[model samples]
Target: MIFIRKSNDRGRSQTKWLSSFHTFSFAGYYDPKFIEFGHLRVINEDTVQPGFGFEKHPHSNMEIISYVVEGSLEHRDSIGNGSVIKPGELQIMTAGTGIEHSEFNHSQMDLLHFLQIWIVPEKTNLTPSYQQITINKVLNQFVLIGSQNKQDGTVIIHQDVNLYVAFLTRNISIDYSLKANRKGWLQLVKGKIKLNNQTLLVGDGAAIQNEKINLQCIEDSELLFFDLSSN
Candidate 1:
């Protein structure tokens, strides 16, 4: 089965400093029908003003990830990790036990655009940790960014999930197969693409179960793919 979540149909939270679109229920934007897909709980496409950002917030038992689409993101956490993440970079924080963090736009003039994702941990109360990596080594192919096993330089997360990223040129095609009893989520970061014959524009997301997927870029595009457990 496949379900397409249109970009325009997502929930929105807008303010003077931040403009965010939520693929699933988030904060004040709750939709009972779109709570989650498998273990993938949240996907927020956010654009922040040059000098404003989210204040310190607390989280627990959730795997948090940040993917910078444009500009730079400055992150500081209670765990003593502080850094500026730019395009083609990904950051993950395991909020086990409990942790507090804040995210801001590092640039004084450029608006920061990024995605923040949250996945429920397999088990609770694990140790908190952080990982970040540059994902520009390969192009037009799925590069593993995070997984349960930490394979191929991917960040280790406390869940049975595999996260892959791809940067494609126009007319390029790619194939992906979902294992038996597993699920998948495809998120379009920018540009246009055709997934399994269905078109997806920027900010669109697709949920798939038990299927072989084929993708062809209609334009230069960037996307993130998640292989998840059925449960």
Candidate 2:
């Protein structure tokens, strides 16, 4: 089964300094049927104005991932983790017991664009931690971004999930085999692609299950794919 979610169909919110689009029910957006998929809970695309960002906020029992798209984000957390996440960089934060964090645009003039993702951890009340890594080492193909095992040269997550990123160009095709009883989700960051005959454009997403993923690159594209245990 494959379910499509269009760009404009997402929950939208705009503030003086922030504009956000939510793929799943978040904050003030609630849809009984769209609360979550598998263990993947939230996918929020955010754009922050210069000199502006999120203030210290608390979260617990969730695995958070942040990927910068265009500009840089300055981060500081209760765990003493602080850094600037630039384009091609990713940040991982595990709010096991509880944690407070803040994020701001690292630039004084450039708008900061990024994606924030929240995944439900397999276990609760674990210790909190943080990590940030550059993704330049995983370009132009499907590269593991996060996994339960730590040997994949990627960030570790407390869940049965395999997250991947790929840069696809026209005339290229990538094939992915789905494990039994697992499901998938594809988030297209830019350009166009055709997944098993289903066409998707920039900012589009699809929920997939019980089938192979045949990715036909219709144009130069950047995307994220999640292979997750069935919900």
Best by lDDT: 1
lDDT for residue 76 in candidate 2, whole number 0-100: 98
Listed in order, each prediction's TM-score against the native is: 0.98, 0.97
Per-candidate Cα lDDT values, in order, are: 0.93, 0.91
Clashes of each: 0, 0
Model 2 residue 42 CA deviation in Å: 0.2
Compute the lDDT for candidate 2.
0.91
Residue 62 alpha-carbon offset, candidate 2, angstroms = 0.5
- The list of candidate 1 runs beyond 4 A from truth reads none
lDDT of 2 by residue, 71-135 (tens): 99999999898899997778999999999999999899999999999999999998999987777
Whole-model lDDT, model 1 = 0.93
